[model samples]
Target: MLRAQDLMTENVIAVTKDTEVRELALILTENKISGVPVIDGTGKLIGVVTESDLIFQNKKVHIPTAVAILDAFFFLESPEKMEQEMKKMSGVTVGDIYAPEVISVQKDTPLDELATLMAEKNIHTLPVLDKEELVGVIGKSDIIRTIAEGR
Candidate 1:
């Protein structure tokens, strides 16, 4: 049976917690990855950062203006106007966006279970660990390729 070790990428590209968001963004773009595991000085997995998190980081909350009344004429209007909201979403750090609670799978975990976990959680990537130490990462593409290999 296929296991996490069989589908994981051993040479995983990880980043430190102190890594700047701009540089991390470049890393993600250059590697064409959806997310990366955040490690500390001792290489312990502490968090996970995804592209969705970065894209929506520090997004300004929109507020509705007022209630709208039906016009007697053919004119129309929408109630949830956002012209008054200020653009206060310029700066944010990875620490501000990263998910501190990470769910990792052990190397011995079965591939079928991994697939189920990924599908159920709607996650494309998961860290693989061996006794709390990051050994690799299993991405959706990796699982697909592994299945394609007739394993």
Candidate 2:
């Protein structure tokens, strides 16, 4: 079975928290990639920034419904969700909108497990880690290409 180290792209393209949204968009477009890993000053993986994050900027905000009863208010939806959406829509840098909870794989992870992780998490890109260091990245395209080659 192929491992993450065998299939992951070693030449990863990453950005810092301070990366501008416009710059991130440009990087994604130029590389034809859907997402990139975000690293800190020491090159440790901190989070991920993806096309979905960028698309959030253009998404319409759904206001939370609320009911006022006797001077008290009840929200049917999560107001925090709306606030987060608004922040993303108005974000200027990756730090403002990037997903901090990163789902990553280790070099020895089997391809099947990797595939399952991606599918279950609904993630298109995953950073490959060696301890706390970012070593590579795996994208959906990489899996497709590997399958095409019968690897």
User: Which numbered prediction scores highest in TM-score against the true structure?
Assistant: 2
Model 1 spans > 4 angstroms off: 58-91
Ten residues in a row with the worst lDDT in model 1?
79-88
Error of 2 at 70 (Å): 1.2
Writing each residue's lDDT as its tens digit, candidate 2 over 37-150 gives: 999999989999999999989987788999999999999998888888899899999998999999999999999999999999999999999987899999999999999999
Q: Candidate 1's residue-wise lDDT over 13-94, tens digit each?
A: 9887677788889998999888899888889999888887767655666554444468433323333233312211333456
lDDT of 2 at 132: 76
Could you give the C-alpha RMSD of every candidate to the true structure, in order shown?
Answer: 6.8, 0.9
Global CA lDDT computed for model 1: 0.79
Best by lDDT: 2
> Pairs clashing in candidate 2?
none
